[model samples]
Target: MFLPPRWLQKDSFPEATTFLAAELSDQFLKLLQEVGPQSNEAILVPASQSLALRSQLRTELSRPDDFSPLVLEGMLMTTVAQAGRSLSRRHHGKPPAWLSRAKELLQDFAGAPPSIEEIAHSAGVHPAHLSREFRRQFGCTPGEYGRQIRIQQAKLHLTKTRWPLSQISLQSGFSDQAHFSRTFKRYTGSTPLEYRRSFTSQ
Candidate 1:
């Protein structure tokens, strides 16, 4: 991952009075405000259909990070909202604690597959919020991420053990061999038996 800039020193808070996750966009607003205090600058943006604000934000998400993928994505979106609020003083970013909660929720939820409500509670957000942004940050929804994680674990078991397919499926979180066979083929284009053979033959 790329190193963060000097501007992002997390410890430089209250004492030095830096930005909170909620205030990130606010700080940017301050920057814009300081440029002329009361004058508005013509910020040219390409996303003309939906609020140009969201388009501008999508652009800032290209930055890399030390946070896990989901956390990084939330942080990126937060940064965008901050940029938008800074430019126009719209001020609509999630609370820093909420974003942190979402990260922890992502970690906790993945430890075992979780219900949408369980995940949302862990993250301190509504189920709808969890479902919506979870997909935005990850290409798949939370449930899909869990399913893929389970499937990948199944792959590991299939390659590393001569265990029977039923046992492998059970151990790796599948409901049954039939379910495992379907998922395995979807992921790798081969049956479990064929996958085991490839690994064993090698």
Candidate 2:
């Protein structure tokens, strides 16, 4: 998708390609401000991931349910979020004990995670220090690590249980299904239903 700073239109759509477009929400625009301004660019979608999304989108379009719009929005937001994260770099080094402790705190949250300040306090450091070192050693912010863990748990639930999306979201430390769907897609490039279908279709 061409973001700001550029515009183009195809006179003839490619038979082999499927194009999906979404309007950026006000909330997502605000998030872009924090991620920093990015020039219009192309992101290559992996074949398998693209196939899964296309299949799911077709199903949702044909069957239109309460969750269809929400899932599509989550997928779009996921794309933007991943683009921002792609600009980050991971540094390799031994992690300090306190940073390890902070990571442990993030993984151990059973429900919604504690604030970064709270984790920093538990790890015996200031929030800024924790944020910096965590990214330095781990390559992602503290919140991102927490999200990874939550997404991991959600994946397990998607594969191992018959639980509905809402139940899995609640049990996997998300505030609600929408939050869970958005974060899950941000990391996995697929929504919960799409991910589950991948396992079941095989």
Candidate 3:
């Protein structure tokens, strides 16, 4: 485990919990809940904390005698990785074979992902086979689809909600208010306040 920098704990640790069990990814983050990813200015803890974590882990893992540092480090890394994969699976929450049929069925799917077995049944194939083909077709796992859906939902909330940023974030499936703010600014090039202002006062 990495030790956070003093700055990360400065005043109050705001963005720390959002990443408690999360993975850093390029397109999206697999947060514990249905929380969306954050953007620039979102990570308040500073890069120092991350650097410290790595350095600490590295230093500790360097010890061999009486430490079993290698084994412990390996386990820790593996666990973090597995958690990410698991969260991705859950976020995808899709059954590949059923997706097309679901598309036909749900109609308003709005690009949401289908479950694994669902995709298999819809494709008239087995789950394993369906997973391969679906990845080939989409350039990403079903998890990407769910991210798109959630991102779109966030967009809608930014456009529609008159509530507080945190409330809008929760209602729209983000991990927290700062996460929503960062993502909203990145995706739309505007803060939630600015985006909402664009709408009519209806």
lDDT of 2 by residue, 1-202 (tens): 3264345655332123445666677777666656644445444343334546667778778898898889888776775565445433222345788888899989887866799889999999999989887765665688877877888899999999999999999999888899889878766667899889878877
Give candidate 3's whole-model lDDT. Answer: 0.50
**TM-score: the better of candidates 1 and 2:** 2
TM-score of each: 0.47, 0.55, 0.36
Superposition error at 136 for model 2 (Å): 0.7
- How does candidate 1 score on lDDT? 0.56
Candidate 1 local Cα displacement, residue 70, angstroms:
36
lDDT of 3 at 86: 40
Candidate 3's clash total is 17
RMSD of each: 15.9, 12.0, 13.5
Local accuracy of candidate 3 as per-residue lDDT tens digits, 101-167: 5334333343334676775676577878666655544334554445545667776776665577788
Leading candidate by lDDT:
2
Residue-pair clashes per prediction, in order, are: 2, 0, 17
Select the stronger candidate by lDDT from 2 and 3: 2
Give the Cα error of residue 173 in candidate 1, in Å: 1.1
Off by over 4 Å in 1: 1-112
Largest TM-score belongs to which candidate?
2
Candidate 3's displacement at residue 85, Å, is 27
